[model samples]
Target: MGQSTTPVLDRVGFAMLSIIMISVLVTASSVFGTSSNPKGVSIPLQERGSPLAKDGVIIPEALARLAYWDAAKQHAKINNSGPPNNSSSLFRRHSAPLESKLDDILWVGEIEIGKPRQRFRVDFDTGSSDTWVFSSTCVAPICSSKNKYIASESSTSTLQVGEFKKDYFDGTEVSGPIYADTITVAGLSAEGQWFSPIDQVNNMEDYGRDGLMGLSFMSISQLKAPTFIGTLLSQKKISKHIFSMRLSSGSGSELFIGGINPSKYRGELTYVPLESQTMWIVKGSASANGRNGFNGNMVIDSGTWV
Candidate 1:
């Protein structure tokens, strides 16, 4: 069956779904329903076992055991396969945890870069169009607090001649040198990926994330590089060009890199043509409290709080 646009219900209002660089963020509070294939890879956006698991936050024992079992199976498969062959063939852990303190607004996930894999905690933002991390050269107080990427240490990293500088809407600016490297997320790898290792940051000293992975379009990218989603599609790492995000108040949040998780939502998905491809901005109208009011362009920002 062909793909379709769908929407899901959650704590927030109706959030429509889309494909390609665009994503639909929804949370289901009802019975599950089946979604079409091209159901790409799913990356859990939060840790499975929460620290508050002992404080009335219950994680089913069966689920916990199943996760461990799946990891073991993947490990055994890797051991038998002998040496990684391709980007997609790399060993995949069952759950890619996005570490976030309970009730924290900042949702962060882990991604591995380089040949041997240098892991870094990154804030997946849809508001921006470039991926950047702290460079080994950055010795400032803020950069010192995060995991710095040493490009020279990675055999697969290729130095690209260019500078990457971006000014975010929040008044923070990041500047660094551009490089092409291998970036792996949720066991799916995008090779020869373009990104920046920032040596300077302004007005972002308190930012706890090691980096920010932009899921926006390439049209606005400063690096003139494809967004991570775009590269994945080009490499055929993910069969579909679409991705979905299910952000929850707890550890249940997830980022589906290819397609929608059928079991996550119900009802038909309503499609909304974007105002522009640069960002996931759409024109829409809504009524609240029996008052039919409110219409304009709404930017679906995953990195920000309501």
Candidate 2:
């Protein structure tokens, strides 16, 4: 299907279901308090277990409902939206298997870089365009706690000129120099991939992951470098220049790098033409509870926490 200029409810609105809830978890530490400890562990999506089970036994119905209700309250409070009317049923339908003990989980995946493959857990964000990682050059306390990418250890790594700096709306920042190296994710590999090796960070005490892997376009990249996903498409590593995601509260989520899994969702998938190549901005109208609230452009940013 071709991308649509007008936003469809199923396409834009429903696509944000999981992200909205997850963003609350992401912003809690950064926006409301100090501390960068992420609540859940980062693991490959394929390895996750059921969210409703404990020791092979289904959790009590009452307990499960209570947990869902609590999560809904948190989601509504953080987003400043109305309380969920029927959160129990909503959770029952969407809740899947999860491997974490947290009430909600932020999806992260593993990727390999360099010749020997230094592994890193990254948040695959669609809001921005820049694949950056913590570097050995960093002496900051935050960088010291997470995995740092070392260029000298990689035979294929090459230094690049100039620095890369990204500032978030909430005051978080990462700055470092650029480098080219081989990066592999979800079985697809891109050679000579340009990325930033972070040297310093500010107001980033709550970020729990090693770095971010941008899934958006190159236009908005801090370095304006070709994106890893774009390289995969250009090299024909993936059949189409597209990907899909499935996120759930306290459940296992999936990210399709180059395609969609029809079984992951119900009904026909809707496509929207990207308003900008920078982020996944699309033309869409928004409403509150079926009542027209606003109409304009929408950025489907998985990385944005507010």
TM-score, model 2 to reference: 0.68
Clashing pairs in 1: 6-269, 7-269, 40-259
TM-scores, one per candidate: 0.71, 0.68
Worst 10 residues of 2 by lDDT: 28-37
- List the candidate 2 regions with Cα displacement exceeding 4 Å: 1-106
- Backbone steric clashes in candidate 2, count: 8
Model 2 per-residue lDDT tens digits across residues 165-250: 97644336789989989999866888888899899887663335788888765656777777776777566575445566665443
Q: Write the per-residue lDDT of candidate 1 for residues 142-173, one digit (tens) a residue.
A: 88677889998899999888799975433456
TM for candidate 1 is: 0.71
Candidate closest to the true structure, highest lDDT: 1
